[model samples]
Target: MTTTPGDKFSYKIELHIHLDGAIRSETILDISKTKGRPIISVDDDGQETVITDQESLDKEIVITTPCSLKLFLHAFNVFMPIIAGDRDAVFRIAYEFCEDCAKSGIRYVEARYNPHLLANTLDKPAYARERGDFSPRDVVITVCDALDKGSRDFNITVNSILCCMTHQPDWSAEIVSLCKEFKDRGVVAIDSAGQDFEPGKDPLLCGHKKAFKEAYDNGIHRTVHAGENGPSEGVREALDHMYAERIGHGYHVTDDPELYSRCKEDGVHFEICPLSSIITGACPEDIMKHPLIRFADEGVNFSLNTDDPIILNNALADDYVLANKMGLSDEQIINSIFNAARASFATEEQKKKMLQDLVNVYGEH
Candidate 1:
């Protein structure tokens, strides 16, 4: 009658969420205090950076309006530094993320972020050489080790997705090598995220070409950020050039019928973060206008995610509820969750156990 023989169905899977942006607001304040760093630092221009308001940090961290993705990304800079300078900060925030997920009943999550970005404190020798936090490889391992510990402690799974920015082609090889070295320690897949296209640049990069090829050759699963800020062509490039098994926020694919058909036929999955799409203006805040419903109508496989839950002020449960408001039935919403687990980079044996646990809890929707 049941599969996994446990109450694992109380667990859920979230395939896409940014590690840096998803840290709790209260945790940011806690870390800032622990590190003795100013919650408010500034740029060269002297604009006060991060949260200055000691009185209302929670009120301030949550962005409550819609804007372009570029502006939407600025929120990350404020709190990223809190975790960047110290290894302990990384461990605490990452562990807390898993702990939060466990409390929320999220069994597994694929957390993604640029390893280089997290190592910003290590970027300048003048600023970092003395403190000695300056190794990207070490930074990545610190984060992964914390996640592994969290997984064991929380009895929840936290998989890492190392994101390579498309513009910064130089970092690709190093990231792939890091994944290769740390795959056993919960580094499951590779991703290319941020700034899909610029005025003079292609969304797809040659460096990723080499890196993803190596990942493919090694049988590592990969995904790319596309069709959210960029055009549908970027989605095609991800599917064709990088051999991406999943497309991140590919909202614009609905603009092209032929490409939509191709993706559905290929069984390629989309990690759709609805509220993030709304906040970034990729889709309207009004669910009725979103192309997601159309994409679903055409049999496109997809999974709902929070993208950056703390940044978006949403969660996996919130996403499913939003899909219901978007006119998808309860069955469809649950199926999307199932799709998330199926599309995960976890091994087949792991998946089987997870699916059985899930079905025992959820009863195959």
Candidate 2:
């Protein structure tokens, strides 16, 4: 078991956590039971297992070993349908996510998700679900409402980012619109997430490029999932074409010396998820050789994050633990926390307060 970083630092800031991937297993089980939906788990041998209890369900959804990105994402297929398309489930998850973050000593967090994935009204639902009246617009409204209340009730500053699935470039326009529509209502940014780019393929799809350009023109904050499973060029593409202010799991940026130098010189904020990197096979299994070590050595502007806590079966503290084990000093960890606060999409006033709070606890870095 990993030690909880909260024991040492009570105030933490997280920049890259997924709202959908951080749902509680207990909540998933409860939703499945209430909906009378049978939980199915498929094995590597092509065998299907029925998950009836929390134990079985956890075993099915939580990944303990390193796996391909394809296998890691399969965990979502097991339970997303149980919660998606259900208004109460969506609201409850957002609220409970705040509570969980508070429990983990996270003072401020920016959660991200694809609004359409939770909306059943899509002509082709993200998952296999019947059509309904709950539009993607409705999803953003519900999420913003729940996050606002949760932020107040839990005493944590929580904002959300609407994601454009990489494969669904057509959805990008609507996603950017939702980001604008809900900018004051808790939505802070737009992110491009979904499948990784195949080798030698252009990382920035044309539609995504146009939408991100629009987001840029409209003053919407932008982040993109690049260079995690894709090559270093993907990171360059995100910076050049998408106006990405921050990068998600941009480990491979180190692969290109010129690009890496540019990112370092430009102070691009990299949201690095240490455990997620290993589990998703974005980095090698060897912890010591992790790009994070190089990032620390090079003084890269980056922050540690829990990319998918449910699938990784970890909390924010767990990521801190892994970073510590990987040779990050206490000072380095604290620096990352401060980096997150500075790079956050929060308003300047809020960011100032958060930084002051950190200084009060950490005593001038």
Best by TM-score: 2
Model 1 lDDT per residue over 1-365, tens place: 00122222356788888888778777778877866766664455887845645446655556668888877776665667666756777778888888888876788788997777766444452122134555778778888888989999999878898988876888899889988988888889999988885322554488887999999999778999999977898888888888899999999987788998899898889999888888898998788988778766766789888887666777677777777778887677767778888999887877887788879877874
Superposition TM-score, candidate 1 onto the true structure: 0.91
lDDT (tens digit, per residue) of candidate 2 on 301-330: 999999898888888788888888899998
Q: TM-scores of the models, in the given order?
A: 0.91, 0.96
Worst 10-residue lDDT window, candidate 2: 1-10
Clashing pairs in 2: none
Q: Which regions in candidate 1 have their CA more than 4 angstroms from the true location? A: 1-9, 41-46, 49-55, 120-131, 198-204
Worst 10 residues of 1 by lDDT: 1-10
Q: For model 1, how big is the CA root-mean-square deviation?
A: 4.6
Name the regions of candidate 2 deviating beyond 4 angstroms. Answer: 1-6, 43-47, 198-204
Query: What's model 2's lDDT at 93?
Result: 95
TM-score (C-alpha) between model 2 and the true structure: 0.96
